[model samples]
Every structure is written in C-alpha cells, then in structure tokens.
Target: MAYLRWVLGRLTAAALTMTGVSVLIFAAVRAMPGRYSDLVLGPLATTADKAEAARRFGLGGSLPEQYGHWLLNAVQGDFGISMASRTPVSAEFAARLPVTLTLTGLALALTVLVGIPLGVYTGTRGKGGGRTGRLLGSLGLSVPEFVLGSLVVFLFTRYSLGLTVGEYVPWSQDPVRSALSLLLPACVLAVFCVAAVARTTRDAVLGVLVEPHIAAAVARGASVAFIVRHHVLRNASIPVLTLTATLSAYLLGGAVIVERLFNAPGLGSFLVDGLDRRDYAVVQTGVLLAAAVFITTNLLIDLVCGLVDPRISALAGKARS
Candidate 1:
C-alpha cells in the first residue's frame, strides 16, 4: 500500500511537471520573433495569403487563446498540422520517432553493458585502477558532444573506416545495413555514458568495499570474486542505477547532436528542420514528445529504484516532510 501510494504520488507529480513543461514549450516557441506564415510564404507572399495562413494555423487569436486551443487539441492527441510538411504533426512524428528511439535504446544498452563491468573491475583493483578510471571519466566529461562527434567523423574519414557515415538505412528495409549505419552513432553516443557510469559504479563499489561487512567477508576467507559479486556489486547497484538514470538525459542531448552529425532521420533532425521552417505544430509536438520521453524515463527509473531499494520512498517522504 505504501509503495502504491508512493507510485501514485510520483505519477501525480510527473503529470504536473509535464503540464508545466508543455506550457513553457508553447511559450518559448511563440516567444521567437517572426510568424510561421511569414517563414512559410516569404516576403513574396501577399498580406492576404499571410492572413489566410495564420487563420488556418489558428494563429489569428491572442497568445492565450492560441495556447488554450493548442493545449485542448493536444490533450485529445491532435497535435495540429505541420506548416512545413502540411501533414498532421502526430503523423510526422510517428514516422521519425522510431529512428530516435532505436538510436537512444541501442546507445543506452551499449553503455550499460560496457560500463558496469569496466567499473566493477577498476573498483576492485585499488588505487592505480581508480586513477585510470577517473582520468578516462574526466576526458569523457570534458569533451562536448560536438567535439567528440567531430573527432569520430575525422578518424573514421581519415582512416577509411568501414563504418557507415552520414547515411541512414531503415531497419525495415534492411536490418543488417541499418545496424551497420547506426552502430557508429550509437558508439559515439555511448562515450559519455561509459565515462559517467564507469566512474559512478567504481566509486559506489569502492564505498561498498569499505563497509565493515565487506571486511568481515574478506576476513572470513570469502573469495575476492565471491565477495565482490555478492557484497560489492549488490550494494553499489543503487548508485549505479541513479547514475544511469541521470545519464539518460545526457544521452538524449547527445543524440540530438549525433543524429544531426550522422544525418539520421530522427526527431532531432526533424525538430531542427521544423524550427528552421517556423513550423509551429512540428516544433511544439517535438518538444512535447521530448518532454514526455524525459518524464516517462524518469518515472520508470523511480519505480525501478523503489523496487530495488524500498528505503528510497522513506527517504523521499522524509525529504518532503
């Protein structure tokens, strides 16, 4: 019942958060200078044409009215029509979202698979290993996504690497070609997560290693691998999960740059194109969908944490109190 209540509370908070984010996204897009019709029709378009465009897009009303209209329609799963594509915003996103999802999912999976084991190894190896891991983490942290992406592109180009560059293949058309196309971008996106997760896991494991129980287990002739597997990793999982959850946000940000760099047909490029064309519906829908992704991901993280460590709820309750 406590867990149920906690989950319910979290759901409520997430709903409120998303509502606020939607409003802010609406306002931010509107806050930009120039009208959608102006961008669509250009200077050559007459005033009457501009007015007609504005009216069609529901932009004839006051800001509040326009927002209210959009909000109401959005609640009904009608994201309006994209001024650029002249198609339903939802339809446009439906086409592009899967590419973004595939990139993000693959990147995250790679990060977890590589990061945890590396962190565990370094954490168990003492001071020298810790230094090496920290240095690697610092390098990863310091390098911005664009720079990292540029470096990858340069190396791949200069070395004539067989990896696909700036070409995207849909998985439905050819799974093997699609996998090859996405692999480099996913690997590039995984860099930051690798550094962050590795460092976090190492620190968490080290902290757990110093616990009295760990010393006792060691003294009891428990094998190194046995103690680490049973004692260190288990206790350190909470922090590892926390770091991964936090890094997920960074992964999304990286995806935006990586998608553009790789010419991947994902939401990042779609949103950028929409913004460039002043396609309000597309931009608004993109931002809302991104917010949904962030909210949904965090909510799942919260639930998983609750399952892994029920004490999390008690801590949250105390914090709230």
Candidate 2:
C-alpha cells in the first residue's frame, strides 16, 4: 500500500511537471524573434508568400487557439510536420530514437561494468590505494566529451588500426560491424560516467564502512569480500543508482557531439540538422523528447531511491500526513 501510494504520487508529479514543460516549450517557441512562417519561407520570400505559408500552416490563429491545437495533436502523438522535411515530427524521432538508444545503452552498460568494480576496489583500498583513484577521477573530470570523441576517432579511425571511418552500420545489416563502430564512442562517453560513478561509489561505500554494524562485522573477522558483498555494496548502491540514472538522462543530449564525430544518424544528429535549417517542429519535438527523457529518468531514480532506502518512503509518508 505504501509503495502504491508512492507510485501514484510520483505519477501525479510527473504529469504536472510534463504539463508545465509543454506549456513553457510552446510559449518559448512562439515567442522566438521571427515568425515560424518567416523561417519556413527564406529571407527572399515576399511578405505575401509568408502570409500564405502562415495560413497554410494554421499559424494565423490566435496564440491560445494555436496552443490548443498543438496540445490536442500532441496528446494524440502527432507532433505536426517538420518545416524542413515536411515529415511528421514523431516519424523523424521514431526513426532516430533507436540509434541513440543503442549507443547510449552500450555506453552506460560499459560504464557500470567498469566503474562499479573499480569503485568498490578503490573504496575498499581507501587512501591506501595510493593516488590511482584520484588520478583516474581527475582524468575523467578533466576531459571533455567532444575532445575525448575526437581523440578516440583519431586513434582508431585516422590511425587505420583496423577501425575504419566510424559510420554506423544498421544492426540488421551487420550486427558485428554496428557493435564495433559503437565501441570507441561508447568508451568516450563512459569516461565521464566512470569517473562520476567511481567517485560517488567510493564515497558512499566508505561512508557505509564506518557504520556501527559494518564495524561490528569487521571486528568479528568478516572477510573483506564478504563485507563488501553483504554490507558495503548494498548500502552504497543507492547513490550509485541515482548517479547512473542522472547520467543516463545526460546521455540523451550529450550524444550530440559524439554522434556527429562518428557520423551516426541518431536524434542528436537530427537535432543539429533541425537547428541548422531552423526547422521549428523538429527542433521543438527533439527538445521536448530530450526533456521527457530527463524527467522520466529522474522520476525513476526517485522511485528506486525510495525502494533502496525505506527512510525516503517514510519521509514521503510523513509529508502526506
């Protein structure tokens, strides 16, 4: 019952938050300096032609009515037609989402696989681990994503050490090639992920190590591995989980530069294309989709946090009371 209540509360919050986002996006887009019609029709287009374009696109209506129409269409999953491609916004996103998802998924998986173990080791070793953790943490923090992407591309693609120009091969066309193409980009993306997660995990685990029960277990001759597996990891994982969720949200937007470097046809590339052309519908949809991903990821993190720490759920209950 408590869990159900928490779920309901989270859903309500998400719906309200999404509503606010939609309104803000709609208003901001409408408030941009030039009219949408003017963007669609180039600078050389006559005023008369702009007027006709506006009428055709139903932009002649009052702002409230236009917003209503957009809201209704959005509710039905119709994000209108892109000014540049004359294709449905949903269709463009649908086509591109999978590629971005695959890339981010691979990157995140590699991050967790490498990060968590290293974090555990570093945490267990504490200051005694020397400066290894600090050095890795510094490198991860210092390197920007685009620079990392470029470096990887140069090393693998420019060097011609078996990695060709990293064009994305469709999974259906050749899964092996597709996987191989993703490796470098994924590794670059994972650098930040690993650094952040490793640092957070180390801190969380070290904090847990000082707890009374942990000390008791340690005093009783609990093996290091057994303490880590049973006590340290389980308690430390909550923050790590939160970090992972937040990083996943960032991956959606952060992929833009990386995708461009690799010439991948993900949503990030599509977003850049939309911006270049001033394709209002495409840009709006892309931004909204990214916002949705970020919000949904955070919400999921909240739920997971509640599960991992009963005290969080209790606090929510107290607020309700």
Give lDDT tens digits, candidate 2, residues 1-321.
777787889989998998899889877776667656656776789889987876655566888887788778878898888887877889889888878988899889988998888888888896875268778988998999988888787888557677765578887798888877777777788899999888888888889989999989989999999999999887998889989988997887789988989888889999898776667677778888877887898898888888888888878877897
Task: Quote the RMSD, in angstroms, for model 1.
Answer: 1.9
Q: Model 2: how far is 3 from its true place, Å?
A: 3.1
Give the number of the best model, judged by lDDT.
Answer: 1
> What C-alpha lDDT do the candidate models reach, one value each?
0.86, 0.83
User: Which pairs clash in model 2?
Assistant: none
Off by over 4 Å in 2: 44-48, 55-58
In candidate 1, what are the lDDT values of residues 34-109, reduced to their tens digit?
8776688887898899888888888887888999999999999999988876888888888887788788888999
Q: What is the C-alpha local distance difference test score of candidate 2?
A: 0.83
Clash count in backbone of candidate 2: 0
Count of backbone clashes for each model? 0, 0
Query: Root-mean-square deviation of each candidate, in angstroms?
Result: 1.9, 1.8
Residue 14 accuracy (lDDT) in model 1: 97
